[model samples]
Target chain A: MKKIESIVLAADLAGTAVFALEGAIVAMRHGLDLLGVMVLSFVVALGGGVIRDLLIGATPPNAVRDWRYPVLAFVTGLLTFVFHDTARALPFMPIMTLDAAGLALFAVAGAQKALDYRIGPFIATLMGTVTGVGGGVVRDILLARVPMVLAADIYASAAFVGAVVLVAGRRFGLSPMLAALLGGGACFALRILAVMHGWQLPKATPW
Target chain B: MKKIESIVLAADLAGTAVFALEGAIVAMRHGLDLLGVMVLSFVVALGGGVIRDLLIGATPPNAVRDWRYPVLAFVTGLLTFVFHDTARALPFMPIMTLDAAGLALFAVAGAQKALDYRIGPFIATLMGTVTGVGGGVVRDILLARVPMVLAADIYASAAFVGAVVLVAGRRFGLSPMLAALLGGGACFALRILAVMHGWQLPKATPW
Candidate 1:
């Protein structure tokens, strides 16, 4: 149990770091002030978990109560603000890869937590997708742009499918670790492949 | 206590109806489909409460658990959809008044709930502002626009000041009803006057 706890913590920290960097990059691109950059970084890194916890009735969400997340996110944000030029020069492929990893981890974790809360399976799956993409949606809204989840890539859909797989695996009596691996792997692969293939949800033409 | 509960319920229902209408009007102007209009109506009507509840750790926020809100919002939306032309022809003054009323009620309710949860006055004030403007933020985001709270009139500031009044009153041992009345009246007056006088928050110019 202790091992599992440690692994979960490690994965969460890793996701937070990756998402914080991504948020910082976006903040820099948007020409936001120092405060704005830091705020956006924190929001993008931990907003999803806070939202998920709120939906599941967890008071004082872990992100708000736990010091580590805010500390790590803010530190990464400060570092990025200081070295924005270098951060700006980051290649697209690596950033996208990290984003996919973060998305997968969040999706699996959200589903796991929801199941523990004994929420119905359907809502739990939706919660997983929300946990995966909710931060980016918020970032886009704050920046005054269409959320990518509703517009550009098949991001939330991928998370949904992954969450479904995790829930299904759990129901089938698979080990939690095994189910998480399968779910995360599926989400990560779909997101990466979608980007590589220029995959997108079809939109109807303007009337 | 029963009287207070009924008043709260009445205010909530009124706010729901008004915001739902507002959301539908925006959706029609944007040429959203029927489904889009209904979804936006539901979201705009209850999203603020949901966010406030989440922030204060009230899970399955009242808006989600109560069937009345969704039903009211959707029915209002449907009516708007069926009479979009008439809805669009609505005079701006009346709509703005309704909006202000809803905002005032929501702001007071948000602060009250936060206080009930034992949140600090400072945060409770912010929560009030959030509850007043969060739905509109979500609505504007769905339409891919900058949130009015950050860009337009002194909307959120008005809510914050009103919340401060409410929290201060409570701290001074004032009755809840009196505090709510003072807070709501202040918020309503500010929002209306801001609209009437074209009051706006100052923005820093680009370098």
Candidate 2:
């Protein structure tokens, strides 16, 4: 693969693996079959991107057009099924790290996509944030739970910060790769730290 | 309410009622609480139409702009909660009949909305079908079940038939309201008969 292609592939792999694990957790909770687990994983990985693309009038959204994404998700899901016991035994710490990485990549990719479409910066930032949390929201809704991002965390806020940074970096003549790395690193580091330390936004007080 | 408003309200009420009952069925199976039941009902009633409208570039999808749709769903959910045992004991036959009516009205409304947007007839027909089945698909996905429309049923197909007929009628100088009713009626009757007699499209031969 070319350089950008390779980067995109890496991003997809990270996203697929993390989302598959999350889906597996839900499946285990629901006592669903292996097939159901795989289905939910695939849906959680692709659902947000598809909805985003469709809303922006991108026909045959990236999830449908890109064979690699689905293939990666499916393979990841299969592996999760095979290693269900081992996976379950592992602590949540490492998986949470992977999830943060995936979120960083997705936020960057989503902002990049909006920029390519010539959408306004504000809209691009919103899209990036949505892309970052879309899958988790879909997963939660499907599981009949509130979305994790909305729960006292700075997940989407971090995405917004990174996207704005990326935009500003580009405006200041930084190369795309350098800017993306800066933004992505910021998001990943911040999210990881937040998760590790149980950091969260203050809850709203009732009047 | 004005005459048209009254008609729209009646249709909305019927559709929401049918959709809420469908949601309640799933909620009962999952043993979710009253709040869960209402949330699922709202999703099932509006999810598909909202998706279709957004894809077609309609601003403020009907479900969002009109408060009545959700209000109807909420009321139906509340009623279902109050009469849980009675609602559960009702035979599937009446519920299926009401579902058929809701399907017909939604199909007509979707086609009309597409035409209002100046989309072509074929695409409008597709939109109609999507609007008719979209909510149910979202609900099923959230419930971790495969959408019922993907099964060997004529549900969406019937919507397509109705849309095409309505378009043809309009082309032949029929009144919009009259054409809509005929087309919608055809869809309602077809669905009712299909469910009653186990009608289905021919399966694709395993090549």
Which candidate comes out best when scored by DockQ? Answer: 1
The C-alpha stretches of model 1 lying farther than 4 A from their native spots are B1-42, B45-49, B52-58, B62-137, B144-207
Q: What's the DockQ of model 1?
A: 0.17
What stretches of model 2 exceed 4 Å from their correct place?
A: A34-36, B1-134, B137-207
lDDT for residue B46 in candidate 2, whole number 0-100: 82
Q: DockQ score of candidate 2?
A: 0.06
TM-score on alpha carbons, each prediction: 0.63, 0.58
Return the top candidate by lDDT.
Answer: 1
Clashing residue pairs found in predicted model 2: B48-B135
Q: What does candidate 2 score on TM? A: 0.58
- What is the model-wide C-alpha lDDT for candidate 2? 0.75
Per-candidate interface C-alpha RMSD? 5.1, 10.9
> First chain TM-score in every candidate?
0.96, 0.91
True contacts kept of 2: 0.03
DockQ of each: 0.17, 0.06
